[model samples]
Target: MKSLDLSLRQKRILHIMQHNDTYITSAALAAKLNVSSRTIRNDVVKINEELAPYNARILSLKSRGYGFESEDPKLIESLNQIETAFFSKENRARYLAFKLCFAEEPQNLYDLEDEMYISHTTLDHALRDIASQFSDHTPYIRLIRQKETVRFEDDEMKKRLVLVEMLRKSWNYHARRNAYYDDNFIEPKVLDFIIDLVSSNLNKYNILLEDPSIVFLNLMIAVMYYRIRDGHILPYEPPIPKADTSVYYACQDILNTLTDHLHCYIHPEELDRLYLFITANRLLDQTTLTRETAKDYFGPNTRLIAEHFLTMIQNYFRLDFSDDDDFYITLLQYIRTLQRRSDIYNEQYTSDFVKNDLRIELIIAHLFQPLALQYLGKTLTETQLIYLAYCLCGTLENFVHNHPGDKLNTVICCQMNMPFLFAMKRRLESDFGNYLNITALLPVNIKNSFDFTDTDLILTTVQKPITRNPATDTLYMSINMTEDDLARLEHLILQRTIRKIYTASPSPHDLFINAFRHEKTGHGDPYSIFRDMAADFINAGFVTSDFLNDIIRHEENSTYAICPGVAYIYSLIPAEKSAMSILTLDHRITWNTHKIRVFIMTCFTLEDMPITFRLANLFYDEAYDLPKIKMEENPDVLTRYYLSFIDEPLTP
Candidate 1:
């Protein structure tokens, strides 16, 4: 079949229909293509001719727009070969970025709209997405807009951004090639030639640079040429970077060589600024260069402040790595980079501390937060804290906690074959490290012959009545352990009571008297059920009338069911008003239109978020069944059941 040339819009419509078998409405296609339904109809006819060569036709429905169906396999394969503007969301982002970056003049709305073949609405959205996307990923250069006029015009930042991107691409072995690089007819041999010249000069000066470093210097030089050649020269007076004389000299030598190659009038301060960058980058390839070699040139104040932070961390964590020279050297380097980053970001130090947060980032932030204001003179971002924490973990991981290893004796009573049992055991050891010892693996044939009384824990495929000590609990697991199972097991290894069904606590029969009705509401209306529950709590003196406000607040947020058949809702209350409530629907009732078999509510302060979080996890366990626990008969049963799973936050 011969090829057919289709417009970008038509190809997109065809691509959408080709991938999806269901009929797509013309109105739907029109909205996506940013055109009227009539235009979509007109495009469909031309698309049909394009497909006719491949013996495929688009199925048009009366109310529905169109679908694609083809008997020939070669038809779809040949369609992929057709080069059209079938750009993905990411491709559009790159295209917009390229247009904005290289544009000498501010681009208007209509111009961008025509260039992209997009509706004004689509172009505006693309611009906004590009700005937001780059703010997170590419902080050096950003997309700017003023009253619908747009361009990317941070020049020095532009050079930095291009260099950063090139370095990133070199490291990202599996990263997708940029679509614009293929579409835009831009010259790169000039880029390559300038890079080669810079690389050659650095080698000639006996400066050992990494491949990415050479690429960066090469790209930066090209950026200077392209901008200057087009009459976009940076001011001769550039801010000098804080650096030693050696780095300043090396930076100048490289720039001098670049100027000679291009026959360009290079500014002197530009050389110093570039030198400052190399010094900040810290990509010195000399193997013999020790941390002290760099530290000897650092300011006295930076060293003193870093030493204070090291002392505080050491005292808090009960760590002693003061003897390690690498630790001191790396700490000094972080201090320097942090200052530069803080200056660039304009992050000011504050006395505020972080609350207990779950993510590793928040934890690290909370730990070093106090030191930031006193020493660094600025608040540290989570990103900065993250880098510090990772470095600390890496350096002190091996020798810090080498006192003695305590291994728990664990037994795996799997009915599977020996090969399968060993594989499962190895996987456990790999995940848990030296925390557990697989002392025994009993097969199904010898189940009765084995004694598990001395074991700490027994894991099996199914629940079995094994004679063991009361302390030695049995955990039933699936043949294939998932990530959730591993997490539960890890917690179980420490707590050993994570899956305890019922710990046998006081039953709450009096909290709800004859008012506890088994009535099921229509569609499980939340307002109706909550009204009745609030009455029961008020009448019983468990809570005051203001409890209704808390209930409404919880319901309005549309609390999601933590487990498959469980929904938990809670709000902060006065210490006196703080109480726990349980309501198990007689029949499955809908809360927020989602079926709820079990409802647990707790009115407590912020200190209890961990308790609520743990309760949700407990209910989500697979072995759990909602109907089995009769809340009316035993209200306090749920209370007793959860006592074993309460874990205080490590910090608190």
Candidate 2:
């Protein structure tokens, strides 16, 4: 019989049908698979067609549902084979990788094809996928195929790295700990013994290991033991210069215990690699390490790297952390530890603390990638980037707290008694004291004569003032300020304050009016739009002739879609003059994964860092209605709408 070419889901449907003597409804199957009932019905039709040659079919009864009917024993044997073979492409690749890595000799193509119950073509495709995965995610390893055989060709250390990464990907935190006793890759007895031994030795040396690190360390030990026992020893390379820290002594003790108990002659080169691994994974007890004494624990270059990192943050994000000793110490410690194992990629994990602000954090992290590569000798993984972002977030919070920008100068007019008016002034001060500076508290009758020259906003209690300064915005509050009134007052204060920080003589409004361009129809892709925008920027003398290519190159490295249906693409290199070009499309164009309608391209000088940062924050704010702004057809209307986020009233 020919091999049945069934998908993993189709094969699963067959298995579920074969095990049941009675008919199984599509609803039940769908519930089991967590798919739609319609999908189950479609899968049944495809499965029946594949099983037809073997004189087997799944019968569908109107009310009774589907039943498996087969007389040929060959059909049952094929179903059993399907159960034993790998189910999905990912699993098949993983199986092939493990077989090749642990094999004593190169694996024959024919043998692998037979063992995997797949045709030669399928196995070849799987091999290509494995190679691609390694190339993209783990650059240190390679999958080599020579005619009719295949094997992994790379450094032994990198081979071990791949093995540990595969194991880590296969199991979660709790599952990994449980795998210590239940995994078949390593003997349960040996794995349990190694974990207990490492735990005891780490404790004996007064070293602390977190849960994830403990699991990772045990996996490393297990992989090293099996590989070394199989005659795969790491070659000796001269070690990098380093201080003899306490973690080094702890690693020595752990390895010495493993060597004596496992009865295997471990190589010294492996010991150095293991020490680096332990040092990278070790957590410092902050209570024991003070700022004055922490310098003693770090390498000489750590301080320089930390200072450079802070300087980059200050220069790009306009956040200064010069005097933040705690942030400085924290960054120094992270740099010292991360530099030790920078070559190892830990992209499989992410910090849960940064989910809400991941986009901004990713941009910040991308900005620092070059810095990390220059100092640490490797680009940071996503997980490490998130850790660095966490440090930046801490510094940003401190900077904002310490330096609240210029407060909004305001005047309040109320039509009540002096006592009640005084009470209202106290309320505004108590609520918005950080953002609002109340210049005067006067009666409603004197609103016309009040000095509005320096006022940023005018708040009236009874009615809207008729003769207020045209440039100064006004808000009407109720006599008894409701929750809605207070919320609106707070929002207005924030808008004015942000405007004060981001706007200058040539205001954002003016810039928008000057650079605004409208496209009634969009092109097939984002590149065309980028080209046109680059032409406009060059004509306006805002950027150089190579600005288009520069933006494209930056976009390839990092695509920024600040919000849904909007993309904010910019160049890191300083331009001739700071300028922005807005392009609004009537029809959406594909940008990365989003169908973007508004493209805001900016070319800013180093002096305009604050404006760049402010624009990013404004577009990313949840309260800013981007869809409404994009819907406006007229350029003047759209520009006003986009910049009028401050004018939008607060919703209850």
Computed on alpha carbons, the lDDT of every model, listed in order, comes to 0.54, 0.68
Model 2 per-residue lDDT tens digits across residues 293-320 = 8677777788888778778767865666
lDDT of 1 at 25: 86
Candidate 1 lDDT over 363-414, as tens digits, reads 3223454566676665565446545654564343232223223345678888
- Best of the candidates, lDDT: 2
Q: How does candidate 1 score on lDDT? A: 0.54
Provide TM-scores for the models: 0.51, 0.66
What clash pairs does model 1 have? 25-65, 26-65, 349-378, 349-379, 508-636
Q: Pick out the ten consecutive residues of candidate 1 with the lowest summed lDDT.
A: 346-355
Overall local distance difference test of candidate 2? 0.68
